[model samples]
Target: MKKDQNDRDSAIIIPFPGLKDRYYEKGISSLESHHFQEAVDFLKQAYQMDSTDPHISAAYLAALYENGNYDDSKRMAEELLKSGIGSFYDVLDIYLMILIQLNDYKQVVATLKPLFEENEIPPEKAEHFLQLLKLSEKAVRNQVMENSPKDDIPFLHQEQSPQDQLIGLGMLKDKNIHPYLDSLIEMLSVEKVHPFIKTAILSLFKENKIDQSILVEKLGKKETLNPMDIPSAEEFPFFHLVKNQMESQLRDHNPVLLEQILDMIERHSLCLYPFEWEPTNPSVWTAAYRAMGYELYGENWNLEKLAEFHSVQEAELGTIFTFIVKLEEISSAIVSPQ
Candidate 1:
């Protein structure tokens, strides 16, 4: 999460009653205005003052989720989903978003299933769900492809930007890590992981010192192996490199800068051979990549673009519009300019 000037200068929150609603309103307005830290502080006060208020609790959960507080957000989101009242669709969207933020794609798909079946989801909505699923699948595939080249069988250490890393770690540390990651891998084998997720995993490994290869190997062996391994090995270096990139980004306190940098990348991005991004507006493509978080930005970039180049040509676009967030983090950093 990016720190703001005011946030750094602000004293610790001192809670008092009768101020919850005011804070809540302020928080919502702040969020709308992209004044995230102030929003968090205010919403937090509201939640503290009236712990039972679903409104306050929901806002708090959303704030935490956006700010990269995954575990707390996840716990709170589940609780809110379980006991709250609002648009079921809204709640489901938020829940799926939380799972996405945590890099827990399995749950994301699982969580969305009932929503689809229960409502007889419209084709448009189903298509969107499928698109998300495809993206998730592509992300995982990108991870496996990225790591496929490591000779020693690089651990499943994920490399993500700081905020994303936190969310990924939360997923990995979840009581259900084994099954959860395993399920994702299985899905990857069958449906293939998204390049974005793959980039995210690679970035996660590069940033943190955690030995995740063991866990990764365990999951890989427990799952499936490609008949061809060379391609996978080639993909491994990206994981670490991408992670390093995001960790560096975490220090920036300015996501907008990264977004600007990405804009530069899109402008100059080459469409080499069959691997090219030929979108009329490169900005949208960049947006989707940004959505996967900055850490994974360059991971499947060349290869996926190559694939996209051949398959979609003019239709292909980047992933940011579909995924990566931390807008508050970026905007906060913008305001503070660290």
Candidate 2:
């Protein structure tokens, strides 16, 4: 439960730790030594201390590019150039370096042509800049970044989220959501789409109070969703409904048992998200409580008592419990111990 909660909260950006004056020398030294990670770690703090300091910003930008944080480097470079952090020429050079590394040759060609035409380039660096412009022109001529078959994966969680589809979802936030409904529906219909991406789509729909009908599928289950009526992530299905039912059964009698059961519900919710344990029966998870209580805690959670309380047949509950054990195992594998 705690681990899953933390994952949901990971979206909040964490800035670099504070640094005192003169500490950026440490970062400069790291950059000189080619220890890119150490350089980013140290210089970002110095950059935070005084973003106006061109020397610190330039070193940090170099570190980020070398560390393969092209997105961060790209953003920093754009800011420096747009705002004239110190000198337009100096920042423009770093910005071009980042764009080349990202293979955004189109942007490189677009940016440099104007600069060269206006005689903006320094004589000493003009030849070097011209070579980059020609290189990018070649790639752009080949139509790179234009005819790519897949979406551009975001820099955040690029290892797991290899495609940039999530950016589409982010764009939908606070929008009408009607114009893009067809695009979203098509994305969901593709079988190759990742579960995490699909979850983000539905969660966004639910968050924005969407009223449209959309088809949703998982494992082998399929349903038409009207997200306006369902629970959002804040009021997650299990935590909203089944949790109250289970608590009613316990009647505040055993804090330890209640805690253990809530943990199971949270784990199951995390494992099965964008979906929840359904039929929303108190008996199903009440039965889970009875079984896991025995298996994990060595307590005799009477099956007959649980069945009687929930007004379900013991035989049927046992059958459901049989599948629950397998489901529980799969759920455990997804939520590794933190």
Model number with the top TM-score: 2
Q: Lowest-lDDT window of 10 residues in candidate 2?
A: 153-162
Candidate 2 global lDDT: 0.65
**lDDT for predicted candidate 1 compared with the true structure:** 0.48
List ranges where model 2 is wrong by over 4 Å: 1-150, 154-197, 208-211, 233-241, 249-251, 267-280, 298-310
What digit string (tens of lDDT, one per residue) describes model 1 on residues 249-304? 53377655454544333222210111223334434443444434444444444425
What's the lDDT for residue 259 in model 2? 57
Predicted model with the maximum lDDT? 2
- Name model 1 segments beyond 4 Å from true: 1-18, 51-54, 118-124, 137-338
Candidates in order: C-alpha RMSD to true structure:
15.8, 16.8
Q: What value does the lDDT take at residue 274 in candidate 2?
A: 56
What does candidate 2's lDDT look like per residue over 1-338, in tens digits?
A: 35686676896755445453455877766665456899899888788778888888888888998788989999988988887776677677768767766667789889999989999898866865776676567556645333432333121223333123443344334545555555566655455565556667777677766787878775456778777866655467455576677677665776556656666766556435656665566666676666776777766677788788668888777866776676577556433311
Model 1 is weakest, by summed lDDT over 10 consecutive residues, at: 266-275
Q: Rate the local accuracy (lDDT) of all candidates.
A: 0.48, 0.65
